[model samples]
Target: MKIYSFRKEEGKKITKYDSNFIMSRIIQSEKPVHVGCMHLEKNGVIGYHQAVVPQLLLIMNGEGLVRGERDEYIKVQSGDAVFWEKDEWHETKTDLGLTAIVIESEELNPDSFMALRIN
Candidate 1:
């Protein structure tokens, strides 16, 4: 989630900064927000843990497997964002590698901007 993408097919084209850029509006939090890049190297894993607050994991590069609640892993790749509610158990792992941006906040609501992922 360190270097996510707009994918060209997603997000709206922005002409303000540059004509070739796209902007994907992610979140607008009234509460304090915390954002960071996560680097999971080959065979890396993020251990299962309960989220203290709502969290959004934005897959930036590579591919990975993630499980939440039901213990079933879902394949995720760049341009995918996964959200976990407070107190929810979740984990992430990769065979090759992946990087993603993690956003955490009590007021985090990704649905306001990004489409819900059924998986």
Candidate 2:
């Protein structure tokens, strides 16, 4: 059995066109399997990027838009959770600012949650 712990720390201020803050707290991780919480500040964009591994995003607060490859987009609000596959390109845009907890794991259960990906 593996046990992981999350410790709170000062988040890094991320600026790529919008004011935002990000805190990466590792939940459980071992090589290909990684889980963590991503805390985002209001009106912040995570910028377009690709997921190296399968991941899940659970909206903790606020509203936002997720843009995937080929302009694929999805709207996410409070209590919304999204799943992203590996090697997929994606980005996040917050409408009214947001805070989301991200979980990346290889042991993803398809029937248990929303599986989202970009072609």
Candidate 3:
């Protein structure tokens, strides 16, 4: 298993379309861009976007909400992990600030299902 640690040194400030956010890359590969943890400043918001593969967003600290199609909004906090599917419309809003760990993989490990294969 590959281990990734998110420390302060790896933190980086990112801005897109006037939104200021911070991200730390604990693990990343050209096949799958993996971001371990990201800290969003107060009042920060990431615009609607989609991922190439499935992603898991685990909130480690602070609070936020995720908005999706049809005005769907889900409140998220520490210990809350939100799974975002590929090509889905979504956006994140930091209301009470935010800190989260984003985990993703390029391809699904086929070996994981060996024991359950009926064929």
For residue 16, model 3's alpha carbon misses the true position, in angstroms, by 46
Write the candidate numbers in order of decreasing TM-score. Answer: 1, 2, 3
> 1 or 3: which has the higher TM-score?
1
How does model 2 fare in lDDT? 0.61
Task: Give the per-residue lDDT of model 3 (tens digit) for 2-119.
Answer: 1122333435778878878766543334475566778899998878887567665666898888765547676777645565566667788896789887767664332231111111
Could you tell me the lDDT of residue 44 within candidate 3? 82
Candidate 1's residue-wise lDDT over 1-119, tens digit each?
A: 11223354668878885477777888898889999999999999999999989888988899999888787888889988888889989999999999998999999767667765553
lDDT scores in order: 0.82, 0.61, 0.60
- Assess the local accuracy of residue 75 in candidate 1 as a C-alpha lDDT between 0 and 100: 86
**What's the candidate order when arranged by decreasing lDDT?**
1, 2, 3
Task: Report the candidate with higher TM-score, 1 versus 2.
Answer: 1
Greater-TM-score candidate between 2 and 3: 2
Per-residue CA lDDT of model 2 for 1-119, tens digit only, reads 01111212323447777867665333344446555666666678888888877766767778788866757666777656566678778788885788877777766543332222322
**Residue 93's C-alpha lDDT in candidate 3?**
89
Every model's TM-score: 0.88, 0.61, 0.59
Give the distance in Å from residue 71's predicted Cα in candidate 2 to where it truly belongs.
1.0
